[model samples]
Structure formats: C-alpha cells, structure tokens
Target: MDCQVIFQPSGRRGTVKKGSSLLEAARKLGVDIESPCGGTNCCGKCKVKIDEGYVDELSAETHISHVSQLTENEKNMLQPQEIRENYRLACCTQIEGDILVFVPEESRSTQQVVLETGKDRVLRVNPAVRNYFVEMIPASLEDHRDDSERLKAALLDRYSHLDKELSIDYTVLLSLPVIVRKGKWSVTATLWKEQVVVALEPGLVEATYGVAVDVGTTTVAAYLCDLTTGKVLQQDSMMNPQIRYGEDVLSRITYGMDDDNGLAILHQTIIEGINTLVTRLSKAAGINVEQVAEMVLVFNTAMHHIALNINPCYVGRSPFAPAVRKSLDIKARDLGIRIAAGGNIHCLPVEAGFVGPDNVAVLIAEEPHKQEKRRLLIDIGTNGEIDFGNKQRLLSTSCATGPALEGAQIKFGMRAAPGAIEKVRLDPVSLEPQYKVIGEADWFQPSQTIKAKGICGSGIIDIIAEMFKSGIIDPTGKFNMQQTSRRIRRDANNKPEYVLAWSEETSIGSDITVTQGDVREIQLAKAALYTGAKILMKKWGTDQVDSVTLAGAFGSYINKESALVIGLFPDCNLDNVVAVGNAAGDGAKIALLDKDKRVEAQEVADFVQFVETAVEPDFQPQFVQAMYFPHGKDTFPHVQHILDTIPTVKRSKLEAL
Candidate 1:
C-alpha cells in the first residue's frame, strides 16, 4: 500500500511506502526536517508530531537518560496532543497509518534565527587519565621482608605506595602478573580512576595530552583533551588574533585587501596565538608539544580561509563565494599551526557563501532542524548568520552586523573575559546600573575588585537600557539634555559620553566611557541584526515564529529586557528566546566526541541556503532606517507601543545592549 504525506509550511505533498518512517515520508514529500544522523536514531533529533492520525503510541520504551538534559519521564511520554505541542523524536517514530502531523517551528530547523541552549557538557572532565598497575614477585625466605619493604628493595628504592596501605581492584590484580611480566617486572600505568585504567605501558608512562580549538573571529577557545582516550583535559580561551586589523569580517576583508601579505599575516597571527596558547597549556599540563597529538580548528569561512592561506577576497564580493566549502583534514604545519608535524588538524566544513564552518559544526551538533517543524539556527556575532531548513529544503544567510555586538568598534568594547562587565541591571526607579563579571563562580560581587577594563557585550546592553530609562536617549537614538547625571559627560572628541567607569575605578588611567561614536557603532550593528532578521522572515514567508535561539557569549550575557528594548532582535516570544553559550565550541566538542559527526557537518553545509545581505537591495535601506535606538514600528510592529513611550531626541541615541 502507498501513503500520501502532506507538509504544511512547504505545502509540498508526496507519496511514500506504507510503512516508511514519518521522517522518510517528510523527506520524500520535499518537506524539511533537520537530521544530522541521516535518519539514524543516534542523534535523537528527527522529532515530529502527528496532529490527526489513527496510530498507536510507540511500544518500545526509549529511555532519555543517555540523552543530554532530558529525564526519563519526559522521554517516556510518546503521544503528542498538538503538532506544535507534541514531543516526537522523528528519527525514532514511524508512520504506521494515514495521519496529519504538525512539525514544531523550532524542530523544523530553519536557518533564519537560531538560539542554542547553554546547558552544554563541554566543561565536564573525561575519565581517560593514565594508570599504572605493578606487582612485585612475592618476597621469599631468602629475600625475607614485608611486602612493602621487599617491593621497595627490589624496585631500587623507588617511591612505592604499598607502605601507605594502598587498595587495588581485583581486576587490576587479575592481570597484574601478566602486565608486569610483559614489561619484565616493571609497568607504566595510565589511570583515569579506580573504575577504569585507560592505558598501560611496559614501563613508566605519562598521560599529558592534546587540545581542541575553535578559533573564532571575535574570540578563541582551546580545549586540552587526552589523545589516548579522547578526553578533554583543560580548556582556555582568548580573543582572535586579527582583531587589531578590524572588528568584523568586512573590516578584516578590507584589511586583507589593503595589504598584499594580509592573508598570510592574519594566518600567522592566528598560528602564533594558538602556539602561544599551546605553550601555556603544555606548561600547565607539565607536558611537551609532542604530547598533543591531535588538534581541531573550527571557525568561520573567512577564518578557515585565512588559516589555510586561501584568498578571501572572493568572499567579500558578489555571490558571496568562498574558497572551499568542503571539510579538510591536513597537517597543522600546512596551516602554519605550531605543533608536531604528525599532528592532525580538522577544519569544519561550510554550508553556503555566508554560512561558514561555524554553522556546519552547529547544525551537526544540535541537529535542530531534524524535525518536521521549521527550525532557525542563528549565530549572533560579528556576522549574524542564520540557517533554515526542515528535512528537505535548507536556507542560509549572513548579516554583516560588524563587531558592536561582540563589544568591538564601541568606545569600550571587549570580548567576554575577565575584568569585563557581563551583567547589568538598571533600577526602574533609580536608573542606577548594577553590573557583574564572569569568574570561576557566579556571585553578586567578584572575588577581587579589578578595575573595569572595558565594556563587553553584556555591558553594552546595560548601557543602552539605562540610557533609555534616564531619558538620556530618545527613541531615535538621540541624546536628551533634559535629564542629567554624573554618568553623562562630553569627551575630548567633542562627542557625548556615557561614563561607565570613573577615572580611578577602571584599569585604564582615564575614564572608560561609551561615546556617541560608540552609539553609532551599536546602531549599525543593531541595524544589521534587524535587517537580517527581517529579510529572513520576509523570505521564509512568516513573521510569527515558535522559537528563536540566541547563541554565543553576547546572547548569554545580555538581558532579555535590554535586548528587546534595544531592538537587537525582532519582537517574539521571550520564553522562546534561549541563551546557548559557546555554541560553536560545543559543536566542535560534539565532533570531537563523535567521529561520524564530521561527515554530518558536511551534510549540514550542503543543505543550508545563504541570502546575501550586502547584495540585496532592500538590505541597505533597512539598515539605514534601523540606525535609530529603537527601530521604526512599520518594520517591527511588535514593539510599537514601547517605541511610542520614548520621546524623539537625537544626541544620545542608539543604545545597544
């Protein structure tokens, strides 16, 4: 028997085998659903719900324990009431009878605007440390000594722990003799814990290991991982090396165009940065460079291009082309990375012209689009890239938002790091700003009072909200002189300044202020965001969305109120807006853990659609109009009432939180 499957959003219908899986039916019908596992159930991503159908619930009990974050009961419930409300794992569910299904908007996995959650397990430790199991021949009457004494005497007085009353697992004892005899009475052991010993050597061996890197344009992060067991050891992060050239891809592109050796220079800078980080990491781990056998490099298309010495000028121009969209595995030295010549460098693939390796890694990791519902994967950074797709069609695009969101270009913009203010709250009545910083733990006040170094993304949000509240900036992003406070001032540049940190309160000798130029920078940044989001919705043919994922450091730190007030994003469900921290890094970690995911990255790259924002005629005008602190209500009707409350002023405009 044949079955007819109908899709709502796509309005594309097709026929499939009677017993085919719902995912397969959707795919057959040209309906989009994100499936990183390629219809496999391993990822648990292909989720769809049946709205109208005569079908029984799944019988086999599928536990959600192994799955990340989900609980058993949440996993046990199989029937979905509303196609929008139902929870169905598409990869696992099958189509047994005629049915009408509703795919969740988030589960559809579109490329318009994606917000990944931050409950990542990348910080967890791996149980793959080295361990040694040694046993000395039982002391005879002739040797005549206690077990500890005899063992120490025979081992040339080495530091033996037998005297300390050590306990050993029987499993270790069971193979102790063979292991010792294999090494001629001496053995080196790599112990992860009492439950598992990952490695063993004929003699003494060390367990210091390798690291993974996601070298982003705005920020760089390194993960120290054990090579033998593929366990992450230590992780470190910093801003990218090319920031001095310019803030965003466009500026970097211009910088590259100006200098003949710009590409190579940018390449070498990143290499040196990574090498310096490697040296520091090795020193901390008490290991040499040789111990790091494998390293992964994940970044955007331009970053990958720069790293590989590819000319990125093409990416800056029409059609928004890239040098290479395919994933490649090569030697670290080939890319000028400092490491053993034998070390491997893995580069994540790219989806489209603007959607680069970062999106590829993210799609493969999150598998957000592996359902019948439409899904939007939005990566907010120097370039606000989006991916929209279901099981069949995928669209992708990039918004050239510049570096303001990441705190670059602003008078006091810095990456989210130590001494960078990350949290800010303005009292509705007082309009006083209270801020917090990121540290080992979350607390009201930081452990040590480091002077305010610079305003990071989170601080930018706070500044914007406070400016709006105090009436210092009107809806048009203009400054109002009616309200006065010590926080407001004028800088030498003859620009209006909002004093974020006092002269003595900051690390810099002078006061750290957010100037008018900074406001303009944020305006352009937010404009880019607005235009990109609007274009996608216009293209995708919908304004009302089920969910919007806010990823990266900026998304995590910025307050929801400030984000909405500044109009960084379109008006949507606040509950749907989630913060997924270090999504790119998390994607890299997923690839590291699962080797098969590398191929899935390529698939994700191939399926996404890229909308060229610069080339689009409407983009620039939308961008210009979006220059104000609050956008025009015509474009964003959702925030009309809020925009109406603020007066029209121009000096201290453009608040970006």
Candidate 2:
C-alpha cells in the first residue's frame, strides 16, 4: 500500500510503500536526512519525530497497527536516548500509514550555539574594503576620458597607493552613468583593497560589514561584523543542511564520491543555509544585504571541499590527501553565497589532511603560540583536534572520535537540549539516579518525568566517571554484574545493563538504561581523545599535561571532574583544565576583524607541526591503553580529591551469595 508522508517546517511531501523507512521516502522526495554510517542503522543521527498519523496506544490494536514495529536496532537505540516517546530512527523506522514527521534542530546537530558573548581581540581598523565619496567634474568633451577611466583617475588622485590594475564587476560599469549623474557627479565608490570597485552609491555609507563563518560538519555559525568599527553587529547560526547527507565529514566524503550529484547537493545545502543566515542577520541588524562586502570561513578540509563543491574523492582514501592546504581567496559569487555581488570570501590556511582551517581557526582563537606556559588545546566534536604548544612552537593532530560523545551512535545518547539529561549523580548507598536536564537549573530526581530524558555527551562522561569512582564500574569500564539491585538486569541479548530511569519516570514510556555496548562507545570516544593528547606529549618529551583547554560547545558543557576521572585526555592540574568556548568560530571572527590577526593565524598554522594519527607508529598502542579508565594507571591526583570527599562505596562485588 502507498502511504503518504509529510515533512514539516519545509512542508515537503511524498509517498512511499507501507514498510519503507522514512529515510528512504525522504531521499525519494529530495529531503535531507543525515545517515553518517550510510543508513546502516548504526549512527542514531537520523532521528525524526512523529507528529501525527501513528497510533501509539498499542492496546487492543485488533491485530493490526498503523506504525510498523521498531527494528531491533531502533528499539535498542531509543532506550538509552529516551527518544522512544515520539521519535524514531528514520533510517530503520518504516511507515505503515500516512504520517507527519517533525525533524528537530538537534536531530541534525547543526544548530550552532553562541558560545561567547564578547569579542576577544582588538584590531587596527584597516579593512580591505572602504567607501570613498568623490566629486567628479561633469565630463565635457574637453575631459574626454571614458566613465570608467574618469572614475579611476578621481580615485587614484584621492588615494595614491591604489592598485594600478583596478578591476570591478561589469554591472558596476553598466550602472556607473546613472549613479554618477544621480549624485550630480558626486558619488560614493566602494573599493576593495584599493584595487577593484565593488559597489557604487549616491552618498556616503556609514559602515561596511563582513561575515565570519564556521562551517562545521553539522552546524554553521555566522557573525555579522562591522568592518569599519570592528564591532560585532549580530550573529546567527543553524544546522548545516548538509547534515541530511551525513553527520560526519567522512560520511559526507562518501556521499559525494558515491553519487555524481552528491557534491552539488552538499555544496548547495551549506550555501542555502548561509544565505538564509545572511538575510536573517542583515534584517535583524537593520542593514542592507548588500552592505556585507567580505566573508571569512574556517572549515575542516572535508567541509571545505564540500562547501566549495570540490570533489572529495581522495580525502578519505589512502594517503589522505587534501585538495589544497594553502589559504584561498574565493569570490562569494563563485561559491553562490548571498552577499555583496563582488564581495570576496577568504579562507584561512589548513593544516595537513582533514585538519583544515577549522583547526587553524581554533589556534588563532586560542593563540597558544603567544603563551609561555605549556598548554593543550582540545576541540572535540564528532572529531577531535588538538594543539599543544607554548611560545616556542605549536604541535597539532586530528583524531576521529566519531559522533558517540555528541549523542549520535549512542543508544540513549542525545544532544543537550530541553529535555536531554546533561548532568548526573549516582547515590553510593542507594545507587539511585539524580540528574538534571537542559533548560533546567536545579537538580531533579530521575523519579521525575523531566529529569529522565536521554543522556548527552557531558552526562555520559559524568555517569561513567562517577561509576569508576564509586566502584560500580571497574577501571576497564565493566559493570559488576553480581549487583543484587533490581535496576541492574540482563537484557534479551544476555548483556548487563543499568537502569537510569523507569518507564513512568521518563518522557519515553520505556526504561532508559545504559547497556554494556553503551559503555564501550564512551570508552572508544575518550580513548581517541586521550591517545591523541598523549601522542603529542610523547613527541614533546613531557610526561606532564601542563594545561588543557577544551573547545567547542560539547567540550564546554562537559564536566571537568568527569573528564579527568575518565582520562578524556592526559592528566593536567584540575584547575588548569578550562573550557574555551567555540575557539574555531572565534578564530574565524578574529581573522575577519583584524588584518594582522589573519597574518598571525596563517603563520601559526604554517609553523605548527601537524601529526597524523593514522600514520603515527605508536598511536595504536596508546589508543589501546587509553581505553581503560583514567588511562589505566595515569593517576588523577586531582580526581583523588573527589574520591576522598564523595561517599564512594567499596568494590566487593556483592559477596557472591
């Protein structure tokens, strides 16, 4: 039977066979839904909420059903994330009847958070584009120069250091006569780098604006900045629509290589999202869309390729080559971004491999090369980028941590949103759960409905780290299966699981539990991060992790105690571990605002030694050792304070009856 399906917000419509997955229908209708594992039903990134047309009350269905049964994968995936209430894994969920699907902003994980409120640096205010109002002699036959040559003379006379090879959009030549005459030969000219004229107006303009963009795998953040005053007028962000193709960069690369039009679709998705933001930010800031005269972007190499519509076929293959690693100046028009017609988009330099300008951007934001004390900068998202250095030199590396810690690929994992659990504490004596959700400040008992949503990256770290300290889980992240509590039980697969919340207590009508599989996901993610940092330490010939600065939204929200207890990275003084919010985005802004800062960013990116984890000889062994809690023996002198103060129970395994 053909069943009708509708996607909301976009108001897209389609039809599919009764048993077809929503992802399949979405693909048929050209709707974007991310499946990073290529729809293997492994990554839980393809989540969609059922808005209507499904019967949830399974009571006495008369031996029939409207919604198809959840696949074993979907059933196992939703419990830990508590998404079973109304959401389904779109890749695995089949439509049995007409239904409306509501895709949340978090499902794509592209919604950018305004991680910082204030600007970080001061600039010299020498911008590339400047508006000059010059009065020209109304041309007579005596002053026989053409309109273009006449304007060029007037501009050069006013500014002697102008480029001799000036160029401009043909439209500027097409409209120059009317503009010059309309202002009585006294017109305003917008010059870029004193080279090409980009815009012409009848009078003086107050400000020239620019945009600094962070094109992440799933999210994009844009800052509308005042180029003249170096003031941030406003900022905007949204899920990178490319998330419909994949939640991770490699998946996106596969999408592009697998389909001829995949590259175009990926390019169009991000361009549309950026254009939408440009319009929104301009209107909100009370500025004309054409006022934005320049843009700067920082992306991981894969995102950089996809954003520019370059074929990413070689990025994921052997040798791991990138299209280009140098800084580029691409015209916004060529990239199809909506801004001033002749505006330019400057991309900062990229390091080797997938560690592109986004990594460089974080370094620009952190300015590690300017510091004297040894420090470690970790920007962990679906992937992890590390920068370690002081004033002498900077060392960096990239690691594929996957999306587990970001809430995808985890059974009960979810983004930090309204009902998503962001904090957790397990009682030592009772082993009952106390947790907090996003959008709520106070801690609430998991016995309450709102407190029992699926866990987020930070909460996952907290629970596992706390379990290690409380003797519930061992250094290897194994559960003491002998526990007598009713909360611990064996699932149908005969694997041990711990219940975080009962069915009635959660938004979902089923218990939210962490399985043995869930623990492994955490182990894998944390190990990647720790190993990367340790490799740098090993290369740097230092056993000490002087300081650690966590970057990005997920890193900022993570509990430092939990991160330390789990050895998310090499050991550092607890107080030295700090969160630097959205360093990559901030780096883009720094380049956008300061010309000198852009040069510095390039120098730092170029000078820093980039270590590729894939080819590193000792990386595999470090990764294996890192899988154990607190790095299997790397003492957490800082974590000992919590272990001593907190009422941790003994590890006696319930006395074996």
Candidate 3:
C-alpha cells in the first residue's frame, strides 16, 4: 500500500510506501529538513507536527490515522507539552496512512538570511583572463600554415605582450576553423594568463565577465563581475542545498566516511548549486554563460575538500591534515561547472588543519599582517575561525562552537527571518522584555498585533545579556527562583523558564520562553569561542589586543555590547571592536579582479601558523571558567561599569534562605 503525504509551508506532495519514515518521505519529495545526525534519530532535530485528520485524496473521506505510535526514543527526547501538541521526530515516525505534516521554520533548512555584500575596495584590474580581438590575413596557396599556428602568430603580432608559444584548448580548437571562416578571418579570443585560448567568438566581442563564489557550510553566495571594468554586474545567494545531508562539516564528513556514495553526492550537489547561481546571474546581467571565462572560490577546509571532490575523512581525524595546501587552477569542464567550456576555476590556498582558504581570505581582506598594532580577527559561524597577528607574526585556529549560537539546539530558536525576534531589551526593574522582529520597523507594541514566530540568534544573545544585566538570571545561567513575576515560571517538566512572548502574541499558539537548557547551550557555545581566542592570545604572549574585527554574516549583526556581556571573546575596548561584513567573500572578489592578489593569497597562507587547541592541556579548565557571565576570573575593564549598575542576588544569600 502507498500512503499520500503532504508537507506544509512548502506544500510539497508525494506518495511513499506504507510504514516509511517521515524523513524518508521528505527526502523523496525534495523537502529540506535539518538532519545534522544523518537520520540516526540521536540529534532529535527533525521534528514535524502531524494533523489529527486529513481528507483522503482518492476516496474523498476524512482519514484519522496518520502516523505510528511514538517510540521510546521520542518519549525521552520530546517534552510533555510537545507530545500533546502532536510533534513527532521525523526520523522516528512512520507513515501508517495518508497524512498532512507541518514542518516548523526551525526544522526547515531553507529561507535563511544569507549575507552577500561586503565592503568594496579599489582593485587593480589585472584579471588572469582577458579578451583580444585579432584580425588576420586570409590563407592563400603560398601561405600554407596550420590554423593554430596562424592564429598564434596573428595574436602575438597584434599584442606584443602575449606568449609566443600560446596554446588553444582542444575543444576550442575543434571549432576555431568554422568560427574564423564564418567571421571572415576576424575573431575574438579569450586567453587565460595571456598564454592559452580558452574560448572564441565569431565577431569582435567587447564584453568579458567572471564570477566570485563564497561556498559556506550553510549558505552559498556568488558575485558576477565585469573583468574589463572591475564592476559587480549582479549578485545572488541561496541556502546551500547540502544542508539536507548535514549541518556541519564534521557531520558531512561522517556521512561520507560511513556511506560509499556520500562524497560523490556532496560534490555533485555543490556543483549543481554553483551552476544554478551562474545561470541566474548570467540571465539577469543579459550575458551568455559562455562569456563568463573565470571563477574564484573560497571556503573552509572540509567544504574545500567537498567542493574539490576530495575525501575529507582525514580532515576530521587527529592532526587534521588537508590533502593539499597549495592553490589550484582546474578546468571548468573537469568539475562539471556550467561556465565557459575551457574556463579556469582558481581556488585560493588553504592553511593547515581546519584553518582553510576562507581564513586566508579574511587575512587578505583585513590586512592584519600589515598593521603594527596587534589585531584579533574572528569569523563567527557554526565553526568559529580565529586569527591573531601583527606585522611580526600571525596565529590562526578554529573552534568547534557548535550551531547553538546560530539558533540551533535551543528551544524556541530560529534563523533570522520575518516574524523572528531579532533584538530584545529588558527593564531592570520589572524584568519585562521589549523586542523587535525582523519584518517590523519598530519595537513590539500592544496595539501593533505583532505575532513573533521565534527568536533568532541576535535576539537570543540580547535576551541572555539583558537577563544577566536585569538580574533575571545569575552568572551561572540559573533562573533567579526567588524573583516574583508573571513571566517567570516553570514548564510542565518542572524546569524554570522566562517568557519572552505570551501565547496570544505568537502564531505558534504557545508561549515562547527561554529555558534553562537554552541558556546552557549558549554558555557552552560562547565558552568554546572565548576559549579559542584566549588560546590564540596566549600563543601570541599577550593579554590584550589593540583592535578586534568580527567577520561573517552573523558577526556583522551581533551587538558588540551584548557579545562582551556574554564573553564571546576576550575583553577589548568597545571603541576598537568593529564588524567587517563577509571578509572572506571580499577576499574572493579581490582575487577575482586582480591576478596579483591570488599570488598574495598563497603567501599569506604560508605565513600564518595554525595552533591546535584540541591538544592544549588547559583547554578544559579555561572553557569551564569562561562559561560564567563575562567570565569567572577575567576582568572586563571596558564593560564592567555597565555590569556594576545592575543589582544581583548573591548565590550565598539564596543558599542561606
């Protein structure tokens, strides 16, 4: 028997065999679901709601049976209230009959806010690929020269800078005779590095373009640029379709190591994603795909390996060695990229261990190596990349901060989107919260009828800081049980939580609250990040940095004060703390327009030293101390005055009571 299934919000419908898991149905129907554990049912991230009844598509009758009884694993993983609301783990639940399921925004992997634009700089327009229009004399009986030889001679005659031993792509050479004859011995040749002809056109084509891509774990962004003018023609971004396999690099690596076809699937998926971006960008810019002759890419080591179709199993193991550390120039056709047939794809050099070309890109964009004062650069994401350096030396490392800070592994958390709370401020006296949702221009008001869906990463940070400053929670991330307020109460599981939005103010028909578990998740995530920064500073033999730069999409939106309040990094002057949006993407764009910058990228990759924090003996203790609000022993000189204004209950006094 076959069961008809419909997933809401996306409205995707499909039929599957009876007793198939909901996760299997989602995969078959092309529905995006977060399964970071690779459908092992251990992560408990793939949650879906089942409607009580649905009308049968063929019989026109209401069917009540939808799913099998909840397994013992679901009973242990889900809260009591969630069970009552018909929430089931998609990996555990099996379809018994026709069903209508609703996947929550947090569970779905699409519609995320992807950051694409970055600070632009004046670039020296020396692109590796250039176009040259050459007019040659027709071949006569006396002048018996081969087509390839004649074309090379004519190119060197017109452009003295071109190499005398220029070569043509075999595919391009096959069509060269027909194209040159059709144009009456006049043609435009696209040469790569002024050495090899990658493409050819019938007439004098004046336009040339290239693409710069930033392949992130969660999102992929592409920039279409005019190689001649060094101007960005069009930009587009999309949620990385590979998220369906896993959310983090390690998970994907595990998937690859455990399954035979995992590496091939991941490689093909990213190629398809890039091809989709190329198609859209070319169409929007009114240019043919063949006209785009070059591409530059940047990503972390695991993503880099997956993009290049290399086995990443070793990248997740001890010592964490990458297959290659040097930059590569591969043919576009070899990678199945939908660009010019013989176009070249240039990948930036990668650093050792987990520090990859993306981190190197950050170094080039910020130029910390050129500054005299010590600088700390942090790119915050699921895996936080940290770099500390000055003119004398540079150090780099990666921290496994997990996905908690990005609204994962927390109750009532979601990505930045419409109806998601982005900012929050609580009153010190009443402990009442005022918030701003993503789609709204103003703070929440009583008369506005705003229905917040969930809290995003920035809002989660703000609320945690506000709770600490307002004395709602202690430094150890425990709810102040002695405080009396309507918003402060215990859940059905007897756990304390502070309500951010009442049931009437949310579309979920339930109150959104910050649970004790949520605070612990944030604490663990922040502690890992802070610990990594501390390790780098120790390696540099300094207690303070002259300046701090936050990079990435999430880092750009973080409130500096709130980040300090949570001890996301080591203490620094608030004035010196700056957020540079998408530095890695900026580095990719810079490399795309300038051929010299690509060489500089390789130099920077070799100059930086990678420190492995996992092997450090003091990591556990430092991580424990950093779990406290603003740290247990470290003094935050710049933000201490703000913390001093708030009154808090002493833990000893509460214990005595």
Each model's TM-score, in the order given? 0.63, 0.88, 0.95
Worst 10 residues of 1 by lDDT: 58-67
Tens digits of per-residue lDDT for model 3, 590-611 = 8999999899999998888889
Q: How does candidate 1 fare on TM-score?
A: 0.63
lDDT of 1 at 286: 73
State each model's CA lDDT, in order.
Answer: 0.62, 0.77, 0.87
Give the local distance difference test score of model 2. 0.77
Stretches of candidate 1 exceeding 4 Å from the true structure: 1-118, 121-210, 227-230, 251-260, 282-288, 336-340, 417-419, 427-432, 436-448, 484-495, 501-504, 507-511, 634-657
**Candidate 3 segments whose C-alpha is farther than 4 A from its true place:** 1-4, 17-20, 36-38, 52-54, 58-69, 96-99, 104-106, 446-450, 649-657
Candidate whose TM-score is highest: 3
lDDT of 1 by residue, 466-561 (tens): 677557676667666555576766655456777765667555455667777677777777777777777776777776555667767667767876
Better of 1 and 2 by lDDT: 2
